[model samples]
Structure formats: structure tokens, C-alpha cells
Target chain A: MAGGFAESGADLELVGISKRFPGFTAIEELDLTIPAGSFFALLGPSGCGKTTTLRLIAGLEEPTTGRIYLGGKDVTDTKTYRRPVNTVFQSYALFPHMSVIDNVAFGLRRRGIREARALAHEALKLVELDHVAARRPAQLSGGQQQRVALARAVVNRPALLLLDEPLGALDLKLRRQMQIELKVIQGDVGLTFLHVTHDQEEAMTMADTVAVMNKGRIEQMGAPEELYELPKTVFVANFLGQSNLFTGPVVSSGKDSIVVDIGGRKLEVPRERAQRHAGEVTIGVRPEKLQLHGAEPKAAAGTNVLGPGRVTDVSFSGVSTQYQIAIPGLGTVSLFAQNRDVGAVLREGAEVWVSWDVAHGFGVADDPADGPRFDPDDDTRSIAVQRREKLEAELEGA
Target chain B: MAFGAFGGSPATTPASDAAPRRGGLIALFLLLPGAAYLSLFFLVPLVSLILTSFQAVDPNAFEIGKFVYAFQWQNYVDVVTTYWPHILRSFGYAALATVLALLFSYPLAYVIGVKLRRFPLLQALALTLVIAPFFISFLLRTLAWKQIFSDEGVVVTALQALSLLGPADHLTGTPFSVIFGLTYNFIPFMTLPIYTSLERLDLRYVEAGGDLYASPASTFLRVTLPLSLPGVVSGTLLTFIPASGDYINASRDFLGSTDTAMIGNVIEANFLQLQNYPAAAALSIVLMAVILVLVGAYVRRSGTEDLL
Candidate 1:
């Protein structure tokens, strides 16, 4: 939590931003404040408008509503080149004809930078690309070219550095290496970094603050650990990690929690009033938290109880084994056990006791108030799209 | 030598199956028609002229010693010594015309290609204007130039009115008229190739250059022009070759300035007026040889055979 708060010098705020393209809205009523020198990430799936948010912040696109404040100045209508922000595009977009030194010095050249060679040398040294400064982009590897792009943007010394999936083209090993490099660079420069990525892993690894976007809006925004530990919606939970959901009706509601009867088994979870309903509630549990024993506990357990079940299947991974257990009156539940010792092995068809702590389950007592009200007409949309594609193919053939 | 870890040694094919089977038949089928046409129209006439070069003309104005086989390779030496200045003049005029054509068309083609890319009809119209001169007869166009640069023409009238010249006698039959006609007739050759190349130039390079902080002009000089060198080479070759050999404009349009007579005029005069078949054939051979050398150098420089 040392760098969790905003820094003092590089404050950026997006105030009540809204952007619409004809009839479609790309981003709506978005607001964010990033402290100076903080690494911030916008995380979302494709078409979630995360890239659009980064573009708007870079002044590449204008917001239909609201203002952008850099430090304290409003720059909502400023053109991209006029703003004090530079972007490293996803494709790296390095000029193919120019040498690495020239590419790095290009922004300075525009500003009529005196001693451009020395400044370019310094920027290349920072990116550890000084030795190859005379080489063209086609001669450099993908990782080296990306570093050149970074050096090119940073040499301008813009107030904010924007990254639009700068590592999206790298392979897994290279991407991991670049993630570390980018983090180190951000720390060394002490510049505000606004990065856009769809990778939850990248966001968790690098960002000081993470904002998860969905359907043109921020679904949740917080530190990675906070979002991971307490997701507020099924979309966030499913996107962040794996979860198994159980559907049932609410049996009782308490001051801070609710008990739901899932297939005759009572499970207690945190009471979120927005989702509180008496019937048709769902409970989510992580598979790793469930435990399995050969049989039920010798005595009646405490609030954390054991359920009788038969192990239907066992899967052996390199470091862990998963057991799928079927409990009577309840559906099959999955249990994950790490290889703690030599003898912690479960076989298929073994009768076992599956147990979980009551507090571990996350409850969402279904409220019709919150959205995605399970419509019956979603199938028609896919059917229409398929039909259109078929018609287009036939027209081309004709 | 050490292919142990990566893979086995490369495979070898049997020598028995190496040669192309039934190859000469296919080759002949593809080439015989063209070969027959060249022999009938080109090869036989060339051989007859070479045979005629050794003969002495009789008093009856008929060529004798058709079969005496008195080989006169000195005919080539005499013709070379007599026509060397005309050869140099042709090259000078062609070089000047090519330079003038490039100057006039490069900006026009660049604008049509890069600036008006979104308006395709405008590009086509611009291209049509460059090619419009070719639609008229070469004789007619040369005649038009003759009138335009003549003493009684409008240009002479205008210059006289402006007092830029003393009188109408100063204007006609100058070398300026010949070069102008040459440039006007062949300017389209310079435009189309350069236009096509500039049109196909990748816009991504420009955007990338701009993003790197390069002004538009620097991008053009550093990225666009160097990459369009192939087009320049092809356009120069296309305009220079035909203009060097052109005689219709020189013979019909301008006064017989020794410096203005192109090599094509030499070939045409020997063929039609002097009735010197041997001289005409030898001169035609020399022109073809020069063209082949220039075209070969151009092709080698461009690293492509399709430079034209």
C-alpha cells in the first residue's frame, strides 16, 4: 500500500465524461482522478470502451460531455498533439524508414530541440537501446521495437504517458518481461501512466489502481486485491477468477447476512440489500475453499458443517488434484486440494465428506431491481446475425 | 556437417529424373509463331541490306555485286563517323526533354495521387489531361507547334506587343519549338508511372512519421521521395527513349538545325530520300543497340525488368 495513494505533482481528473457515436454511446458519465506518478489501468473485455477512454484522455478524441483536467487546466477540446500526453499505440507504429535514434528524437525535432542527438542518446540509454540506435525498425525484434516506441514517446517528457495495450502483440514470455520493464520505467520516471488492457493479470501485476469496465461503464474500481477479495457483481467475479454458483431461495435475513436454502442445505452469506429477495437467490463459492474428507466429521460440527457425498471423479494436475463430489439433494460440488504432503490423495468413486465454512460463500439474494433480468428473447439476436451472414455469403456468390 | 540435433541431412533427388521431360517440343510450340514473324519482316530485310552494303552502284542506278561477297565492314565505320554528332544531339535533346517532362509532371502526379486520393474522378481527369496530347496525330501536333512558335503565330504577336522581341522574324524554327513539342507529346509517359507509384505509397509511413514529430515536408523528402525512386527511373526511361528517336516533330516542325536533328530523322532520310538501304539498316541497328544498352542499365539499376 506504499504507492496506493496519489502522488503530489501529476494530478489528472476526468470529470463527468460522456461520448456518443451517432446513436450509440461509447462511454457514459465516467469520472476518474489519478494522482501524479501513479500507475492506473483500465481493465475490460473487448468492445468495453476501455481503449476509447484512453484515447479521450490522450485528447485524440473529444468527449461529447464534460471536461478533462490535467493538473488543474481543462483540456477537453485540445488536439492530441497540443496536449501534454503521448501514446504508445498497440501496434507500436514506429516509423519504418527512420533509425532508432531518429525515431526517439522525432518529438524533440518537432519542438526544435537543440542538441537533439544528445537528448536522443539519453532517451535510448534509458530504454537500454542506445547500442542499436542506428538500426532501422525492421532490423529490430518486436520487444526492441516496442522499447523504441516507449523511448520515442517518453523522450518528449509529456505530463502523462498513455499506453494502449502496448504489450498486446508480444508473446507470453516477452509480455511478462515487458510488464516488469514498464513497471520499472514508470517508477523511474515518476510520470502518470494511464494504461488500457484487457488482461486482468497485467492490471493486477502493475496498476496501483484498477478500473473494470463493462458495457460502456465502469462496473467496479478499486485496488486489485480489494476487487479480487470482494467482487460486487457476477460479471466481475467471473471475469477475475473462477466461481461456482448455486441457485436457491432465501430462508432468513439477518442484520449483516442472509441464509439461503440451496437444495435443502442452508448457506449463510453477506446480505446485499440491492439483491435481497425471498425467492430465487444465488450463492457463489470458490472451488479452492472447499475441502473433502473420507467421511462426515466424527461429531456434529460447528457453524461450518460437513456434507456427505460420493466422489464422482478425481483429476490430478501437476501440483493439485480436483475432486467432483455429488451430495444427495444437492448438485455436484468441486473441491480443490493442493499437494501438501505425500498422502493427500483422493480416488474416484470414494465416499467423502465435502465441507465449507459458512462465511466463505458469497450470497446474492436475487432482486428484480438489479439488471440482466433474464429475458427470454436473447436467442433471437444470435439467430438474426447468423441469417444476415448467410444472406451476405449468398449475395457474394450470386 | 552437424545436423544431428535439429534434423537429418538434406534429401537428394535422383539424377535420372533431373532433366525436364518432353521440353523442346513445348518450347517450340510456344516460340515458333513469333520466330516466323520476326524472320519474315525483320530478319530477311536486315540480311538483304547487309548484303547490299558491299555492292557498287552501276551507271543504270541499279546495285551490282549482289553475290560478289566483297564484304565492306568499312561502311559501318563511315556511317559512324558521319552520324556521331547526330547521335549525341539526339541524346542531349532526349535528356533535356526528360528533365522538362519530369519537372512538369511530378508535382501534378503527386497531387493527383496523394492529395486527391479521395476524389478518384478528379485523379482520372488529371490523368486524362496529361494523355490528351497523344490523341491527336503526331503530324498535326507538330504542325500546331510549328504555327504556335512561328513568326505569324499568336505567340509572336503577343511578344511583339509586349516589346519582348523586335519583330515576328525572331520566333519561328528555333530549337525551343522542337524541345517543347517533344515534351508535350511524351509528358504522359512521365506522369502515369509516377502517379501509380505515389498512389500505392503506404499512408501508414506518413502517419508514423508525423507521430514521431516529423513535419509533412520532411516526411515527403525523407520517406516519400526515396521510396518513389523506382517510379522516377521508369518514367525517365519511358519518356527519354521515344523522344530521342522521334523524327516527325524534328523534320516537320523545326528548321534543320544540325543540333536539333534526332537519330530517327537520320534513319528516315536514309530509308526514303537517299534510297540507301544499307545505311538505313545500319543506323536502325545502332539506334536499337543504344536503346538496349540504356534499357539494360535502367533495368539493372532498378533491380527489375519491368521498369518501363
Candidate 2:
């Protein structure tokens, strides 16, 4: 599977890359390849090693035990300047002293590109920021500066372009706008875009392929729909979106689907989608995939599974109404139903039936190697505490 | 009306009415000690110096160190005309010394702040060493340097041995020696401000520059130097202003000769040996005015709108 680099002309290839700081392992033997002219995103939670992978590819940091190839040539030992790669930094690291035009023209100027100013203007025009080309970075808003950074990197036309959370500093509205803009821009100039972000929604929105990382390792990599609909790990399921998870033992297997006894209730999931054998497994479906009813619906045949639950919480969002259902002998699970003009508006303390197609359910092989059993919405051990522990250890050694 | 429209909001009216009086009173209270101290120490000396600059001594009155005060403003003209060369030389030497100090300090500060940042212990050690000279007296340091470049000293001897200098040529009692001493003595002042600015610099810009394919040297010139201008301005000011009026380094009895005498040395000679207080006072006033003008022009030219 990894040998595709030879046939398809991989724009970037990282073979067994690992980066270790003094007391922390950033990435552990990561292997990834991106085909030319594709927008790929590395998505993860903080400290999950997505950024380290990008940095290693950009030649900002050297990997400890791997070779990095750009356009099928090993550039593992190349200096950042020598590497034909550019990065849009998270802070938009624009030279504060230079005008926006100069900032955009910086890469070309370094390469001794004649008519740097005219070309820089062309790049700014690409981002629709040529009007503000003469202004310094501080004079522009965060969104404007972000575009300039994009223009700067894109003007280089490097073999690989890495964006380290380029839209992270913008507000929600601007971020959404920029996300679409980025997708359009990527389409316009199809360099091998490698964007790193901790935001799952952003990755789903922009990248053609998304890699979900957890604790210095990639949990799953595929198209966003594939990862979301058929996540191979509980981490991917929880991280990509909210997934109502169930841990149970497999009762029977079929050519098409597998039936698992989830604490008593038998649920059928597509057999190929199940990453486990006929044994213990953890399975989940996204909140929106399950339907909620006032009473038990007639058990439909042909891959439809049914379960009885009671509505514990009712949250009516503008477009969708969400219900927290407490299944008997099973934990509470969330399900979102679209708000309709003619439907029974479910309320708290109402008896409800949660039903989903068997094909919607996905299963993982119930491994104990999960990185932090996380509540998707709840706080985990914060990075500050971990950093403090590292510092204290460092001090003690000192 | 525009000011009133913006300013006279009902929410802020009461605060403004009460605050101004309270603020003025508080401001007065805050100003009392500093203002009184300046009036006593600074204003008094300045008033006496200005008065002395306008005074004249009777050439016939042979009472030792006697001066009957008169509005003899020609003392300013006389001092400027007689000591113009010394004044120009002082400024020239100061400019050279300041430039030299900046050149030496930029690399030192860069290494300490950026290069050694990962090694906090080493960085602190290097910074401490940079500031260690302040522990020693300036006079002692200058005198030590004077010894190092004395007529038959090791520096001159080495230069002679290398044939870079003739046997009769010397490092002491020259413009070069005085300027060198000034640069050496003021290096810490130049270094610390630059270290502060460079320490506060975002390393990501350098990384971004590199990622853009700019070499390290070009990055330093384009990104690092421009951002560190505030520090350079402050460092140069700190070196130049003091060096311009420095007496110890250019004292004929110490490291300099008559030919190498600066404005400060001339002022010293007129005040103590010649006992021409008016000329010295006039020259002192001229030096202060020139420095003020030059520093203002410099600060303005640097366009440090953000820094100041």
C-alpha cells in the first residue's frame, strides 16, 4: 500500500518519521504519503503530533529516524531554505516591518526572481488583497494578514505547501469564510497542500483526505466521509464528530453484517465495516445518523436495528432538535432530529425509540491501546499541567 | 462641537467633572518631589551655568580666580571659534565609537538572545558576563586600557612586531585610543538594549524567512536588523551622548594629547587650568545644545513611532 509513491508521483512522503524532544515524543514513526495536487489535512487534538509531522515535512525540524522525500527526492537533511517547500505559519509570521507586497514577494525575491514587486502584486491579486499591498502587516486585520501569508507561500510554487492552522486566529465567521476560500484557492493552484489543524470541521470542509492523529500516531486516514462513517478507532469516531459508542460482544456474523449484543440489545452493523471478529467490540454511530421516536417503531427488516430509550434531555437548536436518550441497561446516547413543521416535538422525560440502519453503525476491535478514554465534550488533562510536570522534571535533573 | 459630542456623554460627565480635580491634585502631589528635586539640583546648576556663560572677567583685575559678572555673550562666540576643531573632533570620535559599539554589540546580543536561548544556563552566564564590566569602576577600566596601549605596551609592541606599526608610532595619546576606550567603556550600554530587543523578537519571523528560501544572512539583514532598530537607536544614543562629553577618556594627562583633545577636554582645561569659567560654561551650553539637536534629529530620522 505504501509503494504507491513510485507509480503516482507522491508530492510528499514520510517513511518511519519520529521526532523526540528531550522529555516528549512528538511523533512516533509516522508513515504518510500525499499524492500530487491534493489538499490533505492532518487533524488532531493538541499534543497529538499533527504539527510535528507538518514541521518535519517543511524541513523546519528534522525527524529523528526517518527519511523525508519531496517529489520522490530525499530532502531529509536539507536545510529549511534549501528545501523546495513553504509553510504558512500559525501566527502568519509576516515580517512586521515589510509592506504586504514585500511580504508576499519575499519568497520570489529570495530566489532572485526579477520583477518581484509585479509578481508579488499578482500573488496578492490571487488572494484579492492587492489593494492593501502597500500597507504593513500590522495595518491589516487578522483575516487580511492570513491571506497575505497564503499569497506568500503560494507564490513560491513549492513542491509541497504546509499550512499550520492558518485560519486558527480568525473569528468563527471569518474562519468559515476562509475555509471555503482556501478550498477554492487550492483548486485554482493545485500544489500539494498539507494543512495541519486541530479542528475536525475545518479538515472535513477543506481537505480531500484527512488523517486523524492521537498521541503521536495516526488513528485513521481516508476521505472525510469514510473516516466519519466508518472510523476504525474509537478516538477517530469521538474526535471527527460526536459518536454514541457501545461496547459489546459479537453474537453472530454474516456476509453483509455482524450482530453484536450491546449489553443485551442485538445491533447489526455492516460486516466489512466492523474491524473486529466475532468477539468483544466497540461500535458507534454519529448523533445525526440515529432517529428518535415517541414510542417503539415497528422493527423494520433488512438491516434496520431498533432500541428502546427515554428522552433525558431536549435541546432545540435552530435547524435540528437534539435528544439525550437513556437506553435501559445502556448509557445515555445523543441523537439529533431535524426540526420539521409537522412532527411531535419531543421533550424531556418522554419515552423514545432510537433507531438506525445497521449499515450506519461502525465497530472497532475493542483494543486497550486507546489514548485517553475521552468524553468528546469534556476536558482532559490540560497541556499546562503536562508542561509543568515536564518542567519540574527538568528542574530536578538540573 | 465634535469634541463635545464625543466627550460629554452623561455616563462620563460626572466622572470627568470629579476626576479632573482629583487627577490634578494627585498629579500635583506626584510632581512635588521630583519637580522640587529637579528645581534644586538641575535648575539651580543650569541657571548658574547660563549666568556664568554670559559673564566676563576683567583682564586688568589680577585678583586670583576673580570674575565680575557682566553680559558678555561674546564668550560663546570666542569659545566656539577657538575650540571649533575640538568640538568637531569630539563629535566625530563619538560617532565612530557609537558605530563601533553597535557593530560589536549586535552579534553579541544575537548570540546571547537567540543562539543561546535553548541553553538558559549558558544564556544567563553570557548575559552576566556582558554586564560584569559594570562592577568595575569606569575610571579603572579606562586606565587599565590606557596601560594596555601605553607607549611601550604589549598592543603597540605586537603591532610593531607585525610591521603594522613603525617603532615611533603609538596606540596611546591618539584619536584612535580615545575612541577605542569610549567604545569599550560603553559596550554594555549598547549590548543590553539590543539584547532586550532581540530577546523580545519573534523567532518565527526568521523561520518564516528561511521557509521562504531566504538565506540566514539575508534574513538577518532584512528581518532582524529592521526589527531591532529601536534597540540600535537607544544603544547608539546611550553611547554617543555620553561619549561626546566624556572627559576621562580624552584627558591629555590620561590617554589623549593636545592634538587629540575633544570638546570635554577643552572645557576641562578652560575651567581648571586657564580659569576661564565663562568660555567653559559657554562651551558646555553649546555641547548640550548640539547633542540635544543631534539626538532629536536622529530619533526623528529613525521613525520610531512604535518604539517610543
Candidate 3:
């Protein structure tokens, strides 16, 4: 059964693609390429054009401009049916009237393949849903229906399988289970799978390559770990995970590292990790990378330390405890400590020092007008103030 | 009494016992008006009609309404033999009209429901146009069609000029006019239900068909048609049941004459002009039984029993 769908996948290339609807553009002059047999994820929030890109690749929507190539052949003008692509839609969209076996066999029968039912049964077995072969889609649970949807698409053995948030509707546990199952399925079939989702963790966990999309363009794209560790843009840092950012000017540019001055405190970022060398830069450190100490600890030679801040809030989750420390000059910075510490849990109003290795810090070009600035003397301005201001602005505009 | 019988069950759980007994009484009370209305208006008339169908006509009386209560099943036999042609014509015309109406309305419903969905205003306007005919009286609408297809009307004259009709041919008081009237009148019935189903249709299913390597036409046949089968079944039933028993379109004063008379027209003549109540009642019962059987078989074969 696995051998029947073991054909190698085709590489997909989109050149200068732009999709413009009335009054607004869905995607702007985008170029993307997915090497065959790789699981690539397009990760973004809703309305960020990730789904549109998937649709464009699937040939469900024509690009307003630019060409598409599949396996070195231009298929820009090909109809959706003519393209060797299939989609596991966001809603699954199984034919409610069709039995599970028939739903899986639909594509095979359409291509006039002989013995379609036997192949469909094999596909169902691949998804571990063969027991529900004779049941209608409405009769199955949501997770079962989702598996049926996956089986239906994979059975076609299309060159590229487009998954449009295929697990969005499932419960968290089922979604995680399906994510692993999907990766295994992709490996078995050796097909190019383009999974589109808003979930950053899902993308990070399952994709070989993760592309962070914003507005209508790709913010950054690389291997999941590479993109997470070395995000080149502020949006990527903020969207992919929690980041504690500080905007400052580059005071010293050394051959090995760039030192940035933030409200009288100095921090060093590795020269290669710094996107900008001399101009104003926004440096960011992940919360988990930051270590919290009750007292001023001895800092290593290359370690960056910011300190003497009062802990404003402490939340002890089962596996980790998160602390929001408010520095006098800076607004607030969040740090996460794993539950490995056997000492007393840090309480609110406790004085703490935050430190991380200089190598863990990354810097992107600063935009002064984009977000809130931390007032040096006033410690009252926080995320709430920023959010209230944003809401007020939106209300006034509306 | 029904409430007492239900409450007397010994297997009731203590927590649910009182609540269920009260609920049953309330349900019975709520059912009073509709049950009484159906029994008084529908059941009483149905029973009287069946009884009259088996009554013996008075051979000695001069009055027309005089008949003796007896099991004269021959009344059913006489009516069936004398009006079998009319009965067959009624069903045949109804079937053709239903088919024509479906073909005409399916596209209309698709456009209103799916194609124009982005423009809600246009969809609403198109739906209003479909239902606008109901604003006029059914008789008035049939009469309007009769005038449009009359001997001197524009349609007949144009057909004559186009050599589509014989020189001496007339349009009104013909089978074509009657069937045409039936199709036109019940088009809204067919279009509305199909539109409802199509409106609720998730477009992703159609797109999924295309994504699975099915062509545009094939997608429509396999996905769109089967998903909307319930609507089609109901629409056909709505059109056929009434169109088969319609008297206005096939009346002599409307679009039909003696040659195009249906069972409805035959029953009307016996009941009103001829004052042959027993024959009319027997014919009415036959029409009811035949329609019941056909609709039952149709619903069963269509596999939409859940819809009914």
C-alpha cells in the first residue's frame, strides 16, 4: 500500500506572484520555492495571505500577475483540476453524502484509475481509519473525518499536497497527534507537503522549512530552528515566540560584537547576529534564554546583564515559572525559569537581576514610530498603556 | 387519560417521575388545537368522501343529491373506467411540467444562491422576482397566460409567422397551453427549495472536487447535485402534487378545452355542473390514493425519507 504512493514529489516554484482583489491586495509580488519531498509550512495569523498563497499554489486561484512552475513546467494558466495538486481544506470539506471509502476513492476514480476501491481502502489503512470505511463523513468524529480527508488527498498522490490549516478544528491533543501522524505520512509518501497554518508551534514542530508571513509578504523563511534562533526581522521575533525587546543606539561596533546603549545600560550582541551594525537597533532576547537571579551574580566575560529590577508579577505554571520584572528605566521584561530550581519561588516585589549570554541576543533595525517607547523615569507605561492607546486610535479611526 | 397511563409505569426513576408526568400533560394540552383542527376539517371530510364514494345513487329519486348509504364499490370501478384517460393525462402533464420546471429553475436557483452570493442585494432581488407571481391570484395568473396565448395574441401570431404553427392553429385551449401554464405557475416552488439548499451549500466542497482532479462539469454533477438532492426531491414533490390536481390551468375557461381536460377538470364538472357527488367523490379518492402511492415510492426511491 505504501509502495503504490511512493513516487517522488515535484518541486514547486512561484515567481513574482501578486493577487489583488477589489480595494485591497491579498498577496504582493511574492516569490517562493519549495524543493521536492520537503514539508514546508507557511505560518501567519489570519488575513496574512498565507492561505491565499496555498490557494495560488494549488491553482484554485489565478495570480493577478506572475507565473507558476511545477517541476520546471509553467502551469500558471492551468485550471485547478489540471494542476497536479490537491488540498486538504481547512474544514476538511469531506463529501457528506459519500461513504468514507468512496470519499477516499473519489480522486482515483476521477483519474479513471482501475480498482479504485482497493486503493482507497489502502489509503484509509494508512490513516488507521479503515474500520470506518463504510460510514458517512457525518457519522464519524471530527478527528476521524480529518483523517479521512488526509487519506482522500494523499491517495491521489499529487505532486504537492496543500494543507490549509487541516488540523485547526481539532482539539489540542488530537491536533498534536495528527501533526506527528501527518509528518510520518509525508515521509512515507515522499510528497512535497505545503502546510498553511496560523500556529507557530505547529509549524516549528512539524515543518522542515518554516516561512513566517506578514501582511502580504514573507518576513523570513528557513529551517525551523534557524529561523527561530536567528530571526532577521522584528516581526519574525515577535510572531514566532515571546521576545523581550529593547531599542537603543549602537555605541561601539567591534569586529566580533556590537555594543548597544539602552538608557545608560550597555548590552553586547554578536556582530553576525546584529542585522544593523551602526544605526539604531532593536535588540531582542528570548524569555527562556534569560536567567533570573535574586542577587547580582558574577557575570561571565561575554554575558549581558540588566538588573536591579522589581518583580511585578510571578506566574507558576506546572513546568515553568514566568516572572515579569519591571526595571526602573525600562518598562518591563519577562523571563521564564524552568521548574528545576529547588529554591523558593520568586514572589512579586522581589528584586531580581536578568542575565543572558551575549551570543543569545539578536538585533534588528529599529523603527521608532512603530511601537511604544519606554519612559526612562516613569515605570507606569506598560503593555496595557500601549494596548489602550491602540484601541483608542482604532476607535477614533472607526 | 393518556397522562395517567404514562404516569402509571413502575419503572420510572424517582428524580424524573414527577417532571415527566407534568411534561406529558403539557404536551397533550399543547397538541389540542392542531389535533382538533385536523380531525374536524381534514379527517371528517376525508371520512365523508370515502363513505360517499361507496354510496349507491338513488335510481327512483328525481333530485340529484339523493343517494342511499351502501357498499356500492362499483362506483369506484365506473369512475376509473370512464376517466382513466383523464387520469393518465393529468399524471403525464404533471410529470412533463415538473421536469420542465426543474430544468428551468435549477439554473435560476444556482445563480441566485451561489453565483450572486457576493452580492446579497442582487440575490434578494432575484429571489423576490421568483416569488412575485404569488402576489396575483392564481386564477388571474392563469387567465393572463390564457390571454397571452389566445388566437389573436402576439405569441400565436409570431409562431404562425415563424412557420412554427399551422395557419389554422390556435394556441389557447390546447395541451401545450395547459402544460405551459402548469410549468410557469409552479416554477417558484421548484426554485425556492433548490435555492435554499444551494444557499447553504459550502462552496469548499465544490472547490475540493476541483482540487481532486475533477473537471468543472463533473464537480457540479457529483458534488453539487447530490448535496442538493433533498431540495430537488422536495421541489419536485411540491410542483407535481399540486400541478396534477390543479383545475385552473386545465379549465375550459382558461388554457384548456375538452381534449386537454385532466382529472381535476373532470371532478369539477361532476361536482358542480352534473351534480354527480358519488362519482366526484370516487374520483377524488382515486386521485388521492394514486398521488399517495406515487409520492411514497418517489420519496423512498430518492432516499429522502428523512426529509419528509
- lDDT winner: 3
Model 2, residue A361: what's the lDDT?
82
lDDT of 3 by residue, A262-289 (tens): 9899999999998899878888898999
Local lDDT at A136 for model 2: 86
**What is the C-alpha lDDT profile of model 1 across A335-370, one tens digit per residue?**
778888664487777788766665566754333235
Candidate 2 chain B: worst-modelled 10 consecutive residues by lDDT? B8-17
- The fraction of reference interface contacts (C-alpha pairs within 8 A across chains A and B) present in each candidate is 0.21, 0.92, 0.92
Winning candidate number (TM-score): 3
Candidate 3 clashing pairs, residues 3+ apart or interchain: none
* Per-candidate clash tally: 1, 0, 0
Each candidate structure's TM-score, on Cα atoms with residue i matched to residue i, is 0.68, 0.89, 0.92
| Candidate 2 lDDT for residue B149 | 97
DockQ rank, highest first? 3, 2, 1
- DockQ per candidate: 0.14, 0.45, 0.50
lDDT string, candidate 2, B1-308, tens digits: 77887775776655656888898899999999999999999999999999999987777797756787899989988988999999999999999999999999999999998899889999999999999999999888888988999877889999999999998998889888999988999999999999999999999999998898888898888889889889899999999999999988888767888888999998888899888898999999999999999999999999875764
Q: Write the per-residue lDDT of candidate 2 for residues A1-398, one digit (tens) a residue.
A: 11111222247888999999999999998999898989999988888898888888877888889999888789999889888888999999999988899899888888887888887898899889999999989999999999999999888777778999998899879999999998898787777889999888889989999999889998889999898888898788877877888878889988888888887788888888889867788888888998777776887764445457778876655577667888788888888788886553977888778788877888875543454555432112133345557989999989
